[model samples]
Every structure is written in structure tokens, then in C-alpha cells.
Target: MDALTALHNRVSTGKLTEPAPTEQQRKNIFLAALRAADHACLRPWRFLLVEGEGRERLGGIFLKAAEQAEGAALTEAQRQRTKAMPLRAPLIIVAITRLQEHPKVPHLEQHMSTAGAVQAMLTAAYAEGIGAYWRTGPLAGNPLVAEGLGLANNERIAGFIYCGTPDKAPRQAPDLAVDEFFSYWGAH
Candidate 1:
């Protein structure tokens, strides 16, 4: 698929199955992420790829973080669900942003760069016919999660991007009117 087609029609797929992206597909995806626009070329982003037994370890970390945050014990079902979260997709890319002190660039800009990287990865996946979804919730902000991921004090989780084969063909992209979200500024 062409770049424009991927950008215009990319949609998140929640139901991903086995048969994770091939090595070539992953190369395309990661290279696209590296091309994300950045100011001052801080390159504030990093990614953690988890799969197979690694995903199980990540799930364990998630379960620990959730339990710690909840204080009260989680029901068995909830515990199981939390532990299985990472298994939803065959691969999980944990996006992280490492904030750096810059005279002209602020921390927010660094985070934006990471977000752009993630968006590029999503688009690249779409172009490759690979299913992908970016997810973040309370778990993202949990301290235990940060520590478990071995993130430094200055590094923060941007999102967990799950990539795999779609269970079914991708659905149609919604046709949203541009006027609804765009407007003329200082009209001629």
C-alpha cells in the first residue's frame, strides 16, 4: 500500500490473532517509527518488544502493578484478565519516551516525538496488512509498571502498541468530513 493510502485509511484493530508480523514486516514498522518528525533530533523514544515467554513476564508485571494500585485484592477473574492482557496480541511494543533537559525543547515536545513515532508505526503496520492497536490506561501511569519495565526516572511509557495478524479483514475506514474538524482561520 502507498503512504497516502495507509495514512488516510489506517484504523486500529483490536482483535489480533497468532502469526505475528514477519521479520521483514517488523523491519518496515520499526524503520517507519525511526522516521517520525522530531525537533532538535532528540530521539527521545525507545521501544521494548515482548513476545512468547516475554509477554508472559510482562503480564506478570501488569498483574503486580494492578494489584498494588488496587490495594484490595483483585477477584480471580480480574487477576486472570490482567495477566492475560499482554496475550491479546502476539507482539507488544512498549513505547517509552526519555525526557531530556534541553534549553530550547521542553519535555512535552519529547513526548510528542514519541507519539509521532508510534503513529508512524501504526501506519506502517496498516500498509503491511498487519493488525495494530495502541493502548494505555492506568497501568501506564503505575509506578510499578515503570519499574518493572526498567524505565529510568526520566523515562515514561507512551503506550503499548500491539501488532499481529487480524482475525478478519480490516473493516472500512470511517468517512469523516474534513469541515467538521477543520476551520478557516483569518478568512480571506
Candidate 2:
């Protein structure tokens, strides 16, 4: 698919299955992320690719972090569900913003750059026929989850991007009015 098509129609695929993106597809997606607009060229971003057994380990981390946050033991069903979260996709990319001290670019801009990078990757995945979803919730910012993932003090989780085959065909993109979202500056 063309870049414009992907940008306009890409939608998140939550029900991903096995057969993760091939190495070539991953290369393409990762390369696209590198092209994200960065202020001052700070490049204050990094990513952790988790797959295979590593995903199960990440599930363990999630289970621990969730329990820690809740301050109580999770029920058996909750424990199983929590540990299975990472198994939802065959590959998971943990986007991290490595804050940098810069006079021109603020930390928030750095985070925004990481977000743009994730969006780029999502677009690339759509172009390659790979299903993708960007997820972030309480576990994303959980201290134990960060520590388990080996993040540094200067690093913060931007999102967790899940990539794999779509369980079903791609759904049609919703048609929304652009006027509702777009506006001209100081226009009537």
C-alpha cells in the first residue's frame, strides 16, 4: 500500500494472532519510526522488542507490577488474564522516551517525538499488511513494569505497540468529517 493510503486508513487491530511480522517487515517499520520529526534532532527515543519467550517474561513482569500497584493479590482469573496480556500479540514494541537535557527541545517534545515515531511505525505496518495496536494504561507507567523492563531514570514509557497478523480482514476505516477536527487559525 502507498504511504498516503496507510496514513489515511490505518486502524488498530486488537485481535492479533501468531506469525508476527517478518524480519523485512520489521525493518521497514523500524526504519519508518526513525523518520519521525524530531526537534533539535535530539533523537531522545529508544525501543525494546519483545517476542517469543520474552513476551511470557514480560507477562510475568506485568503480573508482578499489577499486583504491586493494586496492593493486593489478584484473583486467579485476574492473574491469568494479566499474565496473558502480552500473549495477545506475537510481537510487542515498548516505546521509550529517553529524556535529554536540551536548551531548545523540552522533555515533552521528546515524548511527542516518540509518539510520532510510534504513529509512523503503525502506518508502516498497515502498508505491509501487518496488524498493529498502540496500547498504554496504568501498567505502562507502573514503576515495577519500568524497572522490570530495565528502563533508566531518564527513560519513560511512551507506549506498547503490538504487532502481528490480523485475526480477520481489515475493517473499513470510519468516515469522519474533517471539518470537525481541522480548523484554520484566526479564521471566521
Best model per lDDT: 1
Clashes of each: 0, 0
Looking at model 2, residue 160 earns an lDDT score of 96
Model 2, 1-188: lDDT tens digits are 88789989999999999899999999999999999999998898899999999999999999999898878678989999999999999999999999999999999999999999999999999999999999999999998999999999999999999999999988989999999999988957
In candidate 1, position 49 carries an lDDT of 96
Report clash pairs, candidate 1.
none
Q: What local lDDT score does residue 79 receive in model 1, on the 0 to 100 scale?
A: 96
lDDT of 1 at 11: 96
Q: Candidate 1 residues 49-117, lDDT tens each?
A: 999999999999999999988884899999999999999999999999999999988999999999999
Tell me how far the alpha carbon of residue 21 in candidate 2 is from the true structure, in angstroms, after superposition.
0.5
